[model samples]
Target: MQPAVTERDLNQADVADAARYLAGRIVPTPMLGCPELDELAGTRLLLKAENLQHSGSYKMRGATVAVGRLAAAGQATGVVCQSTGNHAAAVAQAARRHGLAAVVVLPPDAAPAKVARAAAAGACVLRADGDPHEVVRQVHADTGYPVIDAYDHPDVVAGQGTAALELIEAAEAAGTPLDALVVPVGGGGGAAGAVLAATGRGIDVYGVEPYGCDSLARSLAAGHRVPVTPAATLADGLRPACVGALPFRVLRDSGIDAVGVGDDAIAHAFRLIVTHLKLVVEPSGAAALAGALRVAETSTHRTVGVLLTGGNVEADLVGRLMEGSAA
Candidate 1:
């Protein structure tokens, strides 16, 4: 029998308030309507181009919101966060914009490009060994600075909800009712926020995770949060060990679904975005499209919104990721 899972559900009112808080900080990335994707998936597809966000990823939305809120509160102690990679850059960029000192705690194995990018953004990068869990804890213990948690903070969840709010607006502008929305779940900030924002908006929200790193999926099945044993997967951005408490609460109460996909499918979708859409997508970013395509192929949704959560892949990694496929 599976163990109990944590719940991370938020109500529509809370999501709306969060969106209001993030109104001007994060841009409303365009949602491109794709006829071809719809044709292939058997449903209208709205691609939320968060890949075009300021940090080339959706992490910026949460970072900007989180940092901005702190700044608004006149917190002068500066900001720090632990990340796989993207969140580091996002936090650094956001901190820079707010004139705040930034420190990034990164796993030792974090991509070199990610390290360079965070450093370029004026963040102090501290590399740690063993698991991400241990590293993040140590960073928090050492730095007494309030850690801007990547996925666990309520403000971060609220900020991430802004993405889904924008997507819903875009879909409404296109005069279509969205039946479902798909997002790549890492620590479940974006997925939890998306689910929270979609409530009463008449859209079903689904979180997609890499097969080997199905934290949210496992948590949902367990009816509480479950720590996932890390496995090798190319979707580094979504390889979280456990679903955050807030995200689990939101997922449990929000009635959202979780989908787990394989690495090969994510790679194929990554290549497809480059070849067909001329968009650079990281493996984790492609997970939503993979889920969207799968859902469109199998479900009866008339329209599905796929959030392209990030595009911060290193230039060299792109070649390796799309090696055998056409560019």
Candidate 2:
């Protein structure tokens, strides 16, 4: 197994601490009960609409905790990171809150709107050529800024777990029981966080990834983290080449199961969200709902929480995806 995250960094205690730190920084997104989805799922269906979250994604939660730690430790000589999109925006916003400077290295192929948004968030956004992942090293070497890996860092992972923590707490307050949670996987930080949060709570957490980018699934089967050349799918945000070592061990050790879905099913999920739920979710966000649908057949869980991770897709892309979908 890959090296585990230190017990002290963003462990259970740190999760609580981060929750307290983020109470005012992040909004408590709703657990929207979709009756239409319930019918389709043949059970209680609730969505943790993190698309409504700060920075328009759950990354804000992790970003806040991670940046806050860095800032407090005086490691805040500014921070640098490479992202396809969402994580950069999250980091920019979080760094701003802590009065720290931020620079975002974005892949040339990243969505234009995402690049613009990151720049608008007070980050000095730079377009990197060639290998996107290598951009992190190049920027770090050139700028001497701390390189924040999108989903590999322990504090970030713990901060992401706050979403699950809040969702589970909300379920209790609402007098509803969360039998399971389904989250999308790319770098697996979110899924690892969910597993960490759900532990000993009798809630099963499962991760979903597109068939085109089944890095975590491949790694899980191989008993170690593995790399793959992700095929470009509609869910571009979930196209990481590999699951981070930290998340890989956490998911496996926590017994979280992962499932891969085809692009056809993800398109169907997009239709479901748009027509029935009336939510504007990106293709990557829709993966959680699609995974819930897949798990429903085999899972005995009644009330499954599906996390809509973000709503950052461009309208033109949605229109293009909708054109091919008969649903």
The best candidate in terms of lDDT: 2
Tens digits of lDDT, candidate 1, 170-253? 788879868899999889889888887787778988888888788887778788889988688777888878888887877876
Give model 1's TM-score versus the native structure: 0.91
Candidate 2 backbone collisions, by pair: none
lDDT of 2 by residue, 1-327 (tens): 112245644356556666787888899888888788998888887888898888888988888888877887885578988787888999999888878888998877887767777888899988878776677787678778776778888878888988988888888888887989999998998998888888788888889988869888888888988899898777878998899887887887777888888888888898888888788888889989999999998877879988999888888878866786522
Instruction: Point out where model 1 deviates above 4 Å.
Output: 1-10, 131-138, 325-327
Give the true-structure RMSD of model 2.
Answer: 3.1
Residue 49 error, candidate 2, Å: 0.6
RMSD of 1: 4.8
- Clashes counted in candidate 1 amount to 14
Clashing residue pairs in all predictions, respectively, total: 14, 0
Which model scores highest in TM-score? 2
